[model samples]
Target: MTELREAAPSAGTDLLDERTRELADYCAAMTGRLRVIGQRLDRDPDAITEFLHEPQVRFPVQGMLPPQYRSAGEFPAPLVAASSTVLGQVVATEQVAYGDPNVILASPGPSLSGGVVQALADEQQRQRYFGRLAAAPTHTFFALTEPAKGSAALELETTLTPAPGGGWLLNGAKCYIGNGARAQLGVVFCRRAPGPWGIEAVLLDTSAPGFSGELLPTVGLRGARISRLRFQDVAVAPEDLLGADRSPSRRGLYGATYILYRFRPGIAAMALGCAQAACDYLRTHRATLPRQDRHRLDGVLDRIAAVRHRTYAVAAAVDAGVVDVAGIGAVKARAARVAEDATRLVAELLGPASLIEHPWLEKTYRDVRAFELMEGTTNLHTMAAFQSLLRSRTALQPAAQRAVDGAARH
Candidate 1:
């Protein structure tokens, strides 16, 4: 227990802590720059469109390291802090909603691919694939959700069959994939048949033959570059298989689950930032509203504050290495709700002006809707939270356990 506790701090420390004012200040300064960039992007429609497709706009190459610094180690806490800060800044600007498809693809997008590669790929394989990021501004994606199989992501229809000589043949389509059309590399999930072990993932170069992508238009997050990808006998090398080559990992969806657990909190923070921005906007215009309307706005502000604090608490726990996986889902779901509700309230306060005149709040309403569906759906989080609660209750039921033990003895 002592050793475990000792090892935990190696992961990262809380930037929010008073002692870490330097780091906090650093994050703030960077976010301020991001805000300026976001505002700039918002002004030019063509610039924002081009920015969506630019690899550097979302995942800046400046944040990446040289080959010497790269290693197959646990994710650094600083990356999460930096990512959350970037996302929050962008969301707050209510610019192009850069965080969702951009930061989502930027941070966790690579993290998921890197984690899978590290966990499953050989050392040589790791160096080849992971090196691409540092080599240049590369875009990578995690393609799991299909049009029909989003909710049942584990039950993949994409099939991977053994190629004639040495690789696997990939055939199927993936939809609503962030950065899919633009990514240089991606981890595509597939199955041999249907059950747990059948579900597997493979790394592939997006430029490979037999692979094609069509950009999927979205109501919100126009810059996200979401794509519907079709793979027609796209050959994947044996080394490209995640976890293990040839045979699939029997544990079933463990890799996907791990990625979600690690990244969901940051995504939640993105939503929280949106909510905070809405509250901030509302507060600025609060005095102009009628007296009766002020009370309702105050109530909305309190709810937004609650959600923001809850998100921060979860982020702190994550940094301390003490957060429950299920708690991430809970926090994300709550944040999504708060963001959606806050934006709706703001729209109501602004009336048609928000919809017609101001693109900020209008875009935000659309962007926040994506949060409830992204990372994990609200229903999925609800189930996870309920399951977590049940487990906690069982752990605390000492008397019931004792009764069962006595019955067995008798």
Candidate 2:
């Protein structure tokens, strides 16, 4: 929560600030390139490497790096500032995702791993890796999902045992790791002993001996290159362990929690963007449709606006030192459902064959689905929201009883 409060909101009456608006305009310009290469990348996931030089692919990646690590000249103040903050990223991601979520998802950058880096990496670790990323366009993955269990603390089977000579040996298999196969460097989470406190994170090099990553089959977001990684006694240097010098309590699973808090807004924005794209597409193609369908589209658009504002508000709250996990969870879950519903409604409105007829819409229909699986599942979020509801009921009891007592006296 302390780290969450670090990003102060820039001065603005509107939800978006001037810098955020500038970044949005810049992202809007890059949409054409993403639209162009999206299909190609879908057909061949490896094609992501070919477009590294493109602004859409290059800028967002550069935008995520802090000013100090940015090797690129003068970290364009607008996008660069937005790049570091939750609210800034929320504005940028929604716009970029409008064109194609795959463009940002598949691009080589810190991305999902950046939050973890910020949450845990020490000065030396940050300088060593972020510096390398700044110097070149390198794909990165945040390895948490595992072969058997999907990041369940107790069920996690990955191990980081001490090596015979020194340091540690990483042995595990991670599934559903985006950019895992192609990534030259990234972070991996594993357990050194048992229980939650056993968890430890390490800076991982794809080239390390016994480390292997392979692309997994994906129906949607084919360009995302969701992959599987295997580590068989892969050696980890002492310096590679994140927060190793800290006490066991400080080095536990909270860092992972912090990363989730940091990125939930951006995740919601991705879904919102996808939903908006579908709605806009349907409006353009089916404007002459009967009044009923037009009204339905209007309702959908309204929902997007309401949810967009909610997403922005939650992001601003986090920036202002209020990390309302319940609100955030509800927003992320609702955004995802809205995205799915938008695509479904648009498909019906656009005609039965629209999915087959329109290539981009079809890709979008497939792409929006991947968001539900990102960060956390919708079910998990809804339950968190429900838990908050129960807590709120208890929290209001004292005031509620005082009001009742005053009425009784009267």
Candidate 3:
């Protein structure tokens, strides 16, 4: 309880958190072993399940779930200290990611789906969903992206029809969903009728009739079991529709959007961690390189520092209940770009042969690229940032043109 007293002036967060610093430090120490398993998991994605309960793998996953659901000892004391805030999640997520993004991704406990539950699930739904998680170490996924819809997820083609007798039927396909094939339970988005307000989300079981999912041969982040799903009139109960107890306006898309706003920073933190990993890899192996090459690596470190500080600031803002949509979008987009940039620069400076020689750095390159496509792409975020700026009147507009004698008409 002492760890939760208040933010201290000078221990961790001079950069981290005065109290949460210990958790961040502990996570950093654990990455070495997590990294080993991460690489092995990349080689064989199935290997993850066997190691799910190991402390390095389980601690971070447990940390993400509500403390009420997880066992007492899984979280470090520092983690318990910071578990109450979005910033604490950010700190824990970033540091654990520094070990291996796959380690956390493969060990499931709600994840993106949990965010939706937090935002819109009724009390019963909350217990039912999270209770399933509390029962054991389980895998859960969020299914929204589709083959045709891409990032425009709100324009859903999937449909949820009322059953002849009662309950409902879910029919749609979602692709590029993480942990889709292997997850025991999940959340699916679909349209109950026409128009924007018609769309809704529901809890689903992969074993339900008419549901099928298979892994996609993804080039990166292979451990996530990125997969394609087809739903052929899958059964869904009226109770399964999340937020059904709430008004139409508060259900469906609102919760999905809520998910994006709430989880974007943590996603960004993953990219930030991978960037740090790439940069650290560059620094260690650059000793044999020419002096000029080593200096370029230093510049990348500076950029990482700048990005880290801002990521923390944005995460803290979320904790303060500020959802600056544009800012959050830009943070995710920028962090991903920075990660790709770091990996690319390191690959170049270390020489082409270096990727072959250093497997960890090479793996980092692939994983960072996957980070770009996570949640949304860089292009989507930039447009979102611009739109936010325009809405706020912060974006610069073109100067008004006046017809003059010298002006020529096209």
Candidate 4:
């Protein structure tokens, strides 16, 4: 643990020199903000929720960080770390205020890949000029999953039909949409003009006519406000399209792929946080327990630490650009499973204490379980990785085929 701490600075520097310094400074400032938020939440949790709803506080990044940082792997680590602090504050505040056990499974801002961040930044100048605001506690939805389709994103079902006036009329319903009910703006993935395979992302105003959302009562991460969104003849102006106005096939898959890669690191980070929290809870409660319990706690702690380390290593690989996108599925799959194990460990250590609502352990346990199903489920990721490997093998066969042909000719 001490070695990991010592190596953090150098590892950060190796990723990006000057940018790392800027990130450190930014993190320091964010830390202060988070401290203040945490204090306020501790005192009056409702205030934190209300503050999050405020436009000013809702857009935390605002002018503080530039959007260009999203493409580089080095940029998101500090930003995500800072964001996680805010998430922790939210969790703390929610628990304190409502006395209800809930978990924050989805974040409103950019994907770990920085795509949404870049999109937001590009639109910033226009948003300011038009005074057409996009605010948060601003809910943003990743409408990738569907009921009819398998986890294969290429089989998307939602369709976006272009209108006569160059606007768009969206006709589809998105399920498992996090922040669907409360989000003012939504980033919806849809197939434009044709069918599911032509997926594209478009920004839509939730208040617009023909936009509706229904709550999804979930088993965990209940506080995340997951829901199903229906867009029936929802009229969206041309400007709502997130990326370039190219063919959906050309842009949609690329955007989705980018999101997949970008969010891998963030997912791992969240898992690490959960594992650390679980381990800490166990450590704190171990002393009062029996010797047998203590030994069990120690074993759980060791396992948690190992999983946390593995999660961090995966994030580091992403930052270094050493991660294979296809292989990322394996990492994500393993991380989700590890998160489940860590949650279980916490439960075992806490015994009846784990069931209590006040402590974060119970909530985190439920929240971590959600990870196993979110993004690409563990089974789906495994299949994707295998398919990707098979594709690579198939691509290599042409070389061998040509070599055999040449030998025969000789």
By TM-score, the best candidate is 2
How do the residues 1-410 of candidate 1 rate in per-residue lDDT, one tens digit apiece? 00001011111233334323333333333343343344443343224434444433443322233335333243334542343332232222222222223333333235456555655666776677767775555667778888887837667888999889978899999988877887888788888666787787788898899999988767765545678999999998877776674355532266666555656766676676566566666666554888777777777767755655555566566556676767778878987898888888888887767667656566667767888878879898899899999998989799789999999999
Q: Runs in model 2 with CA error above 4 Å? A: 1-13, 71-75, 398-410
- lDDT (Cα atoms) of all candidates against the true structure: 0.61, 0.80, 0.79, 0.54
Question: Across residues 10-80, which tens digit of lDDT does each residue of candidate 3 receive?
Answer: 21265555566766766666777788888998999889978876888877766566667777765655566
> Candidate 3 regions off by >4 Å?
1-12, 288-291, 394-410
RMSD of every prediction: 8.0, 5.5, 6.1, 7.4
- Give candidate 3's total backbone clashes: 2
lDDT of 1 at 347: 83
Q: Which residue pairs come into collision in candidate 2?
A: none
Tell me the TM-score of model 1: 0.77
The C-alpha local distance difference test score for the whole of candidate 2 amounts to: 0.80
Candidate ranking under TM-score, highest first, comes to 2, 3, 1, 4
Model 1 segments beyond 4 Å from truth?
1-15, 18-24, 30-111, 245-252, 287-291, 319-323, 394-398, 401-410
Clashing pairs in 3: 13-16, 13-17
Residue-level error in angstroms, candidate 1, position 283: 2.3
Tens digit per residue, CA lDDT, model 4, 227-274: 888888998776777665555445666666665665664454455445
**TM-score of model 2 relative to the true fold?**
0.92
Model 4: colliding residue pairs: 113-262
Model 3, position 381: C-alpha lDDT score: 85
